[model samples]
Target: MRSVKTLLVPYYEHPTERPDAWDALLAAADRLYGVVLNPASGPGAAPDPAFAVVAGRLRAAGVRVLGYADTDYGRRPHAAVVRELLCHRDWYGTDGAFLDQVSAEPEALPHYRRLAVAARTAGARTLVLNHGVHPDPAYAELADLLVTFEGPWDAYGSLAVPLWTAAHPRERFCHLVYAAPPDAHVAAAVQCVVPGAGVHPWGTLPHALEPIR
Candidate 1:
């Protein structure tokens, strides 16, 4: 089956401080389906009111925002920590939650399962687990979609692409990377991996993978 494509747009501006950042995002937003409000970096850090300010604007502009909560950022228990994040859905009015820093261990699946269930119960329409590597089939089945590979530009072609292509139904996967690369790089990567694998260009603009296209 062909996969759906999506681009990951940043929560707000670019990390490098580009003035055209908002324009770039708005221009790409209509071309994509969703955006991720990642508070993990940039101005997303806590005590920075920019997250809410930017996320609110994105929502008003008609983009589906998914909050990024890095479980590994603080070396704490994910469930208890994530349970607190669920409230962000209400605050941000986001469509779902994307759990970053996901563990790859088979034993970790149970914890993720619990989180997935919690996300749904909290009325999250989507749940994404960022495993940072090619998804294990067992882990893939647990969440709505899995973030299989998140690495540097140099490794994207040699490592991530091959690892991703080996898996089928790429439509249900996500690749999170910096946007310093061109759109063609993203386009090619998406096509080479899973015809339908969603691309998070600049980690925000979401373009659906349409195999038929």
Candidate 2:
């Protein structure tokens, strides 16, 4: 049977600030591919025991845990990026890395590809690129999922997915919308994206993830 496709959260809160984030994650674990864990500036070199416990719990519950790492739109040196990926692996035992600040240009493709390789080498089974827009189709080949849309709800209503993306499996695509409408509008937001697309809706800034039903 085909697996169910549901929400994917860009969970930006540190575990300390929102301990309830763990509960929210656990409640929706079955519907999620994973949640992104960001601490301090990013996933710092040392691990927090609290985060480690959360990661372990999420893993035991069969949900993938991804460490957040910013590439500064590929401006950061490759070695530095790789170090963060490895730190996430060794420190938090994350199953993958969510590469933030990804660029959509074709020229940046190779840079991301190398990062993907490094992530895999560092024990990341899943690599998600948060391009925050529809990127060059070539990017589709580099990561498991591309976050093609991320903004306020208004923009999401008019969002469009490139024809090339349609050629690939829908599960490889994700959408995130902040300042989302009321719960009544959730279905409409879900309908805006293609079937099998991972969707996340947040009602406020610095969005906290809601359980996906």
Candidate 3:
């Protein structure tokens, strides 16, 4: 059977505020493979036990779970993202992580490699470098999943998915974009090219333009 693709929900809040989000997410999960939560999205937030509760619920219901951190954005301390993720394992209760904003430059790869190692050491699988384009060949092997496309709806089809899928197998790739008016259109284009398209509609456009916290 073909492996199912999952939608990574940008973790919008702690456990107390997530009922609506969880309901909507589970509804989506009913159709798709699973959901990934990004606890690193909320500002001034410390790890919450409630996250663990929800994570347990999702896993019990048979969702393939994952978590995230936007390591490449702004002045957000990269180490802090790592620390928070490690501490809140109970909150995410997933098999692995999607480390966003990794370096594509060849020289910088090793640094990211270390971060991947760190994440792995903390009992999390490390999938790094979500470059929304066809990344360097060296990057393909570094992470469990290379997020090849992450951008606005308009840019989805014009960039990496086509070129990357043509060269790589459908199983080795994934893509994420904010949900927008043309989301289905974008998903159709991506799935046509690569069956491994993982589309994440962040409910609204991600505050990607502003510095991700």
Candidate 4:
């Protein structure tokens, strides 16, 4: 049941900037596990009115609206991170949190565990950690979904999934690939494959969910 959403979209563009892309995302809401809303890459200095509207729409469509939280690979202060998560919740009424730049080492587990606890205490119903690689198998327990793979299309085929992944349900993992081939196939439980590449890959809508004209 946790694996119901097959796509975890991190479309970073503002709704006003890309109205069509946001419209397309709304049209494909049924297939989304969640959409990561990055208002100035961590809620900005204050709340964004546009993001709030989009979040409301996504929630109405039965899609989890996740607020983006950058961990700075655990270097950022914990309180700062929590503040961002809270801002996402209070400002946009997001039901989930997308913790990005997460550290994948076993030693960093305690730090993340604490952060995860803070997130839950603050009312994040769904938590996703974007480790961007197959982290220590134990990293799977700190959040609801682990982004085990994140890269370009050319590097995806050569990826080697860790055997430890077999111990957990596939739903526990997600893959994010940009500049992906038109016929790309991702065997993971959840994914976000986009054709847009360069400095920012997530700004474009996934081709699979082409805007409903």
Candidate 5:
């Protein structure tokens, strides 16, 4: 049977450092929702030739290459965030933006909506907002995908699904669970569960996706 689950990977390692991991990710192109590209937390000071190459390769493989940009919970200047998106486009040729550190409060919706429009205007075909928790249902309108739950594996079971979220399509929400066990249950349509733990859990690949030795 074909795989029904799609993974939204947020791997933070550089291509040079994890060439094998990148290769493995490419091999699972069919199962990927998107691969978030983060060079120096956000796009670096200058265009990275290596990231550009990898971004191109991912795009060619029919995977969305998302440039990682921090929204700083609406505190960061809109212009600064837009600049990062532009850098991602110019430097890596990414077709999408993954807005991280997003605010979950209802009050921040307006700011995020404007930012979402800016991302699209900047040439982002796919936009994902990482709220890292359930936000106001209205927030769902601002992006293609919303990371509603992002936390350690232990917290996954105790997570309470708000009734408000039931109204939205499952595909609209995603959960990112790190330090996952072999049997970790991903609670959303889009899944990303990794076994790696500590400060850089995402530095490793998801259990279901591994490189052949």
Candidate 6:
């Protein structure tokens, strides 16, 4: 069996909601590839002091701490997106940016590419594009990782990877399934994912966010 070290968590809630959960997540940081720390609305300018502490802790443990920034499906202005990336870097010292709500359209490719560059310029070491689906193959070159699947277990079970994606490293892809069943079900879901791809299964809303032991 492949080790679950490839897990990448979407940890979208504020640190204050569940401080214990955040502690648990940091404890198992070595097993994870990274985590997305999203504030209430979006990547706000003023950083939450609590989040800064959490982000620093994760980074200290060698876990990649990523700041979340919504692209609004590529409709939002480029300058606005870049500002969020900068805030993540300057405020929380996040190692990367999780560009959420990304578009799969070919035209939107340039938009994301630009953001990726801006993120790197602002000290972002990694760039993850959350398309939540298999996007045009051209998007593969724009970021370090791509979220190819984001939904419930049943839908994820039927997910089919495009042939083109096979040409890229499996590690470049990620899969997220919410409302997961028991341990056996989670194991089954991981089996369905391509080898080397990151996979995470959450059990409830405000997801359990437990470490996969």
**TM-score of candidate 4 to 2 decimals:** 0.96
The RMSD of every model to the true structure, in order and in angstroms, is 7.2, 5.2, 7.0, 1.9, 1.3, 5.2
lDDT of 1 by residue, 82-154 (tens): 6555656756666777677788777667777777777778767877777777654687767777777765555
Candidate 3 structure quality by residue, lDDT tens digits, 1-213:
643444434444555754765655554544444455665462126655667677777777766556666677323465776775575454456666666666566776666766777777777753544665656677776676666676655566476344545665654666665533432444422221211223434533223211223
Assess each prediction's global lDDT (C-alpha) against the native.
Answer: 0.56, 0.71, 0.55, 0.90, 0.90, 0.73
User: How many clashes does the backbone of model 6 have?
Assistant: 0
Top-down lDDT ranking: 5, 4, 6, 2, 1, 3
Clashes of each: 21, 0, 4, 0, 0, 0
Clashing pairs in 4: none
Evaluation by TM-score, superior candidate among 1 and 4: 4
Please report how far candidate 4 places residue 94 from its true position, in Å.
0.8
Residues 27-121 of candidate 4 have per-residue lDDT tens digits of 88778989999989898998889999999999999999888999988899999999999999899998999999999898889899999999998
Off by over 4 Å in 6: 1-4, 184-213
Better of 3 and 4 by TM-score: 4
Q: Kindly report the root-mean-square deviation of model 6 from the true structure over all alpha carbons.
A: 5.2
The C-alpha stretches of model 5 lying farther than 4 A from their native spots are 1-5
Instruction: Give, for candidate 5, the lowest lDDT window spanning 10 residues.
Output: 1-10
TM-score between candidate 2 and the true structure: 0.84
Task: Write model 6 residue lDDT over 1-213, tens digit each, in one string.
Answer: 533666677765567776777887787665678878776445675778988889999999898888888899999999988888778888888888888889988988888888888888888888888888999999988898888877766666788878998797778888766655544143221111211123433312223345334
CA error at residue 4 for candidate 4, angstroms = 4.8
Model 3 pairs whose backbones collide: 51-91, 52-90, 52-91, 179-201
Better of 2 and 3 by TM-score: 2
Clashing pairs in 2: none
Q: Which stretches of candidate 3 lie over 4 Å from their true place?
A: 1-3, 11-15, 28-34, 40-45, 73-81, 126-128, 160-167, 187-201, 204-213
Runs in model 2 with CA error above 4 Å? 1-5, 184-213
lDDT of 4 at 151: 91
